[model samples]
Structures are given as C-alpha cells and as structure tokens.
Target: MALPIVAMTLSSCGRAPELRVNDAVVILSPVDSNPAALYFTIHGGPEKVYLNSVLSRSVIRSEVHESKVDPKTGMVTMEPTRKIEIPAKGTVEFKRGGKHVMLWGVNRPARQLKELEAEFIFSNGDRIIVDAEVRAATAGDADKKDAHSGH
Candidate 1:
C-alpha cells in the first residue's frame, strides 16, 4: 500500500506598480509674483527619471532649479537646471528650502486655491500630468493621494 501525497502552490496575481511622482507644490512669493517655485517628490519606478520639461497655462515658462549652499561664504545660490533625475526605488524631494520648479511671468495673481494643469515631459516620452493647487506660500499644497504622501 502507498500513502497519498498533497502539494500546494502560490503565485502573485497583480501587476507591479508603475513609476510616479507626488506632493507637487508650486510656491509663488508675494514679491516675485510672476515667477513661482515648484517643489515635489518623485516615487518608484526606474533608477532615474529624466525631466524633459514642465508646462503650465498660468505661467509663461517652467524650469527645474537647484540651490547651492556654500559653507565657507555662508551664501546660498540658485540656478536653472536642464533636467532632474529621480532615483529608482528611492525618493527625490523638492522642498521650499531646496531644489524646486521656477515658474516665470504670471499675469494674474495666484491667491485662491485653483487647479493648474502641469504636464511633466520625460525623456522616456511619457507625460505625467498633475494638477497643482495654487495657494499661499506657507500652505501645505501637496498631492495627498500620490505615493510620496505615505513617506
């Protein structure tokens, strides 16, 4: 007589999550109302994301900007960047006191909270469209549903 045998198998049933970005905030100072700054964090995907360009109707132009803090001179300077690479499985945070987006030439005042259309052009030929809410400078105006929220 032979004993019966039993076996079990397991498998994954869902597609892997795609690369994305979150918590995109564009801050417009009261002084330089025309030109605004953008800050956001990029979520998972590949090792890096090439930010081709940024678009908005409210502003004439949008560019990636970075800040340089000099320890010796105790001075901080900022300049325009061609593109930004968001690390894969990592996080790229664009904060107020750090690297951000520079939006120039605003004809109207961005006082009230409004949804501004922004299409992020990537080197991979992928477009990530985000609705940026225009509010006060100090206001926490970041996307909550984005992957960057949990972190």
Candidate 2:
C-alpha cells in the first residue's frame, strides 16, 4: 500500500506544465499597415500561469492589449496590458472586442503570406509556438461563427 502511494506521488510530481492555444488567428491589414490584432484561446496548465509577451517573426514588436468600453461615452478603446494571468485548469481567451495581442510594424510578406508563427512566452519560462491564420477584417461574420463553435 505504501509503495502504491509513493508511485502516485511521483507520478504527480513528474507532471509538466502544459499550454495550448486554440483557434489562433491574426487579422489581416493593408500592405503598409503597422498594426494588427491576434486572437486565440489559451488553455492553462495545472499551475497558475502568466502570459509575459508575444513574439512573431512577421512583426517588429508585439504587445498584449485589452479592450475597455466607456459607459458614458459609449466608445471602445484598446489599452496595453503588461501581462495576463490564467488560473490553473482554466483558460484565457483573446477575442474580437476583447483581450488580444497587438502586432506592430508588420511586413509586407506577412500580409501576403496569410500565415505566421506566434510564440507565447510565460513567466514560468514555458514557451508555446502556434501557427496563426490570417483573415480579412471584413470577415466578422466568419470570426463570430468560429468563436461560437467549440474548439
């Protein structure tokens, strides 16, 4: 009985942190555009996680951002966020009109290619790489449809 208990403990200790991104996408912009937004769902691991930053070869810089709406003004604004915390066994979603990754100074090739690789860096030194699909800004209907469907 003691041996079995010890084995279980060891198994639990060996569990590594896991991060997963679902339905990752980048919104397409014009040829000389300097800014774009990336959206996805980040599934957390067994431990609490912090999203430090986003990296992409297609962009000169990337930052995390959250959308805020003013009640009186009835206007929506995007604000820069330093980091995002995801609860253990939970998920953080970056969606349209919500939290998202902002990419600045995007290159022409990235816009034409319609595909790019994004890397998510975590406070725990864990990195997750994902391929993001590019879609036109006019595809709001399709984006909404995909958001509602289960990934």
Candidate maximizing TM-score: 2
What are the TM-scores, per candidate, against the unseen true structure?
0.73, 0.76
Regions more than 4 Å wrong, model 2: 1-17, 139-151
The 10-residue segment with the lowest total lDDT in model 1: 142-151
Task: Residues 80-113, candidate 2: write the lDDT tens digits.
Answer: 8899998887989998778988887766676678
Query: Which digits, one per residue and each the tens of the lDDT, describe model 1 over residues 1-151?
Result: 2222222222334455466767876665555544667677777575566776788777887777777677898666677789888666667788755677877764464435555667888777888888776654443544312221221
The total number of steric clashes, by the backbone 3 Å criterion, in model 1 comes to 2
The lDDT leader among the candidates is 2
Q: Candidate 2 clashing pairs?
A: none
Q: Point out where model 1 deviates above 4 Å.
A: 1-14, 32-34, 107-113, 138-151
lDDT of 2: 0.78
